[model samples]
Target: MSRRPPARRRPARRPRRPRQQQEHLVGLLLAAAAALWLMATVVHWLLAHWWILLAAAVIAVLGGIGWWQQRVQRAQWEHAQARALRYGLPQLDALSHRQFEYTVRDLMYRDGCTDAVQVGGQGDLGADVKATDPHGRRWVIQCKHRRHGEQGAAVGTPELQVLNGTGRPVHKADVVVMVTNGRITQPGRDFARQQRLHLVDRQLLASWAAGSRPLWELLPALPPPRKPSRLS
Candidate 1:
């Protein structure tokens, strides 16, 4: 453009440090020397006290073997206890109200709901037991214990109403159930069926407690098994 103003000269770049200085040669040499000395000292010590390492290795092996044997023995004892345990309607009816909730939790655990827990107490919001089945379906169970068994006051619609309202929105249950070692009134059963709620009546409870089938398998219209990632 207008003779392009006499070509401007670019300023010279600052010179780089000398190769030895830039590489930090002295520091690198010192570090290498220190590392070599440390390695030599460790090797000499290990050689002089080799029996200590051998003793430690032997102790570790013995400890591991002992731990493994104890674990196996414990597992066998648990299996024997499970085989001896039994459940029936009479057994369930004899339990106190709180014990009934714990029994339900234990049944869930026996059926492979390893995370089953008894949450019944004050402020339970109608959920007595909560568990996640092996299929990843969440369960909220309400236990109604009748000391008189089937002859006691029947489980009525009021309890079902509370469970229907809170079981899903509050407990995030995929399958909501009412478990009683007693009868549910006709109206309660009708409401439960209409609302897609599951019921474990005295008869069904007997079968579930006595048989090997999982509770989910015994109930109808359960939600499809969910992905483990989808479980809360």
Candidate 2:
């Protein structure tokens, strides 16, 4: 009797929604949001004085700008910190990088170098540092200082080669300073001298490292080379 009683009736399926319905719903939602935002803005304006609205707008713009700059500076600092740490410069690595960078800069400063970029570029055709001396002379400074002796100061021709190649591409570059803590290879030095490159030798650098001749002490007017203590 149950089997034959009747085929159980299935509930009717709901009609499928049309694609345009979703689009319509989205449009409606956006319109509602815009209206709500407008209403809120109007209410804020009515409740506050005109000056208050102006002040709030200015504050918002300033806050946004400040936040952006902080983000950029933090990113730069983090990258620099990471690079320093990777190279055995600890949390204090920034200080060390700055110290050595300052030393390279000191040469320019001693000789009246101005408007220097501490660390120059990262992407295609970038230099380690870029600076302009007081005389409107442009200097490309390369700083090479390794904790181990293997990475000493003494830029080779390859680096010079890179600079030489890149320099021609730049219209402003006038001088290239391949700075290093180690002595330059004879070939490199010979090439530099022959190429009219300026040399900042290791003996002179030792004076800075030893603190007997801090960069601040040197001026464009420094006297001729004088014997100083040896650097181990």
Candidate 3:
């Protein structure tokens, strides 16, 4: 029998640094900049004609240093932004259930899904939004609008069962997508991963809405389903 190696430990998350540390860093930077500026001023007073040249050189160096500092901290700023999103997920816009389904369908159309519809009144086992591409491929979607201060959870694995055709087709659906305007519980994300479902949470939708995502076409408004209805 082969002996198994012990699991590698994940790196410990670093504790957040103190606000004073950042202030200290900023103070030190400003001091260095002021020192350089003072030196430039002195050079101007003494060297006269050469002072303009010295000041220009110092300004250029300071600008370059500032730009480099921003570049170095860019990744940290992005991480902070993601953390902010996690804390403030509810402040994100959450649509009504039906409207959410339409927003999702519209996004898919932007991604080139020309035909899509919300699955009629199945409660949980039918695809919420069904779509097809020009190539004749089909896709199904589940939209979950997570409201603020509302529930213990929203959208689950049955959506896969739903997309899989309510236990009959057994994976006949070509594609399955799930969208939400808030964070999913860990179990929900895990379920999606285990069963091969796509989960588009708040950040993903906002990114799409803000034009961060590249898609073929987009309808700003979710159009009504093409099928004729007697009520209409």
Number of the top TM-score candidate? 1
Residue 50 of model 3, lDDT score? 81
Worst 10 residues of 2 by lDDT: 85-94
TM-scores, one per candidate = 0.73, 0.43, 0.44
> What TM-score does structure 1 among the candidates reach?
0.73
In candidate 1 the C-alpha lDDT for residue 167 amounts to: 97
Rank candidates, lDDT, best first.
Answer: 1, 3, 2
Q: Total clashing residue pairs per candidate?
A: 0, 4, 2
lDDT of 3 by residue, 1-232 (tens): 9999999999997766777799899999999999999999987786867868889999999999999999879956754543332223443354567766766665555554546566635564656677765444456666667665235355565554455444225424555666667666677677766666666666666666555332212212222434453322
Cα RMSDs, all models: 10.7, 12.0, 25.8
lDDT of each: 0.91, 0.57, 0.59
In candidate 3 the C-alpha lDDT for residue 149 amounts to 25
lDDT (0-100) at residue 143 of candidate 2? 65
Model 1 misplacement above 4 A: 1-47, 228-232
State the lDDT of candidate 1 residue by residue for 107-197, as single tens digits. Answer: 8887778789999999999999999998888999999999999999999999999999999999999999999999999999999999999
lDDT of 2 by residue, 1-232 (tens): 3556678899997766776799899999999999999999999876876788788899999999999999999977754543332212221123344466665654444333446556643653536667665444566666665443334455677766665666546624666666555567788877766655555555545554443343324323322332332320
